[model samples]
Target: MDTEMTSEGVAFAKQMLADDHAAEAMGIRLVRAGIGSATLAMAVTASMVNGHRMTHGGFVFALADTAFAVACNSYGRTTVASGGAITYLESTALGDELIAEAVERTRRGRSGVYDVTVRRGDDVVAEFRGNSREVRPRA
Candidate 1:
């Protein structure tokens, strides 16, 4: 697990985000990178707020998902999440910086599993389960 796939893979992921309407709209930023892990952050602005003025759950989910994608794909051979889900345990308020970290869990021949956590300071906001599909690297 490298921070990004390969140098080219990293560039490719960045390029993929160019047309990602949600990524662009949410201002998600890639923060930390590792072979088996990736970290991401997003600011909770009014646009991300829910009716209660707290951060929307969808916004948190997207941040966690991006981190999961990066961590699972860091092998540079192209891995796509096959099956996964997440649970929201707590609400994060707007103006709080949301951070997500994806950690590798298990792997089979062509698939990998991971656990992603979203947090605000010391509070755990959400938990995510991610499954990755490993594919042959493009030459």
Candidate 2:
């Protein structure tokens, strides 16, 4: 719904999509990307389950983290996560579609924070917070 990203920003996102083999391997799909926000979705597969037969927290975290990465880097600056954490609130089963929405919380100088909420339909499944730092290109 928000359309504030520049054409170059969109191109940058596409480039990321083309090169992100890890995310693609997990079946993560990009839904939308804006200046400081992004939405991605993935489905829980049998390989992604834990001993309890529920989706692994790491996989969910990966989904949210990918969204956070895309959102933070959507502005076209090469960025990397300084740190990140996730809190799981619900469990999902195989074939369940999960969506992660990342939004920029704040940006100061070369550092920024983002919040990613993972959901199963309308239910909240997990929450992620990521700290990012923009890395300058060499002169």
Candidate 3:
């Protein structure tokens, strides 16, 4: 949690922020990034709402997944999610600023596990767990 990121980690995070068009399009912003952890945030917009007027689950999931991706790749090796799962605890309304915090749970060789907690203020919104594998450098 307090571990400082190495030079490689900083470079990797910068590359990711520059390349992540999907997250940028969703208005996701990098709140913090460090070794094996990352925090991201996005505001729920009217277009992100579902039929119930709550923010869509997919958007919440995407935010969590993005955080996971950032954390897992903080080591600087190209990594990709092997799988992930999420549970929704509460709904979010328009203008709600949602935050997702991801931390490394366990890592073995090329594989890693990350836990992401999504929150709207102090209210828990969702929980996500992602499994990742370090792949080769991107071409």
CA lDDT of every candidate: 0.80, 0.90, 0.91
> Candidate 1 vs candidate 3: which has greater lDDT?
3
Off by over 4 Å in 1: 1-21, 135-139
Q: lDDT tens digits, residues 2-95, model 1? A: 2444465555555444446787789888776666677888889989898888888888888988888877766566787788798998888878
Best candidate (score: lDDT): 3
The candidate scoring highest on TM-score is: 3
Candidate 2's C-alpha runs over 4 A off are 1-5, 137-139
Poorest 10 consecutive residues by lDDT, candidate 3: 1-10
Q: After superposition, how far is residue 55 of candidate 3 from its true place, in Å?
A: 0.4
Q: Model 3, which residues run further than 4 Å from truth?
A: 1-5
**How many angstroms is residue 21 displaced in model 1 relative to the true structure, after the best TM-score fit?**
4.4
The TM-score that candidate 2 achieves is 0.92
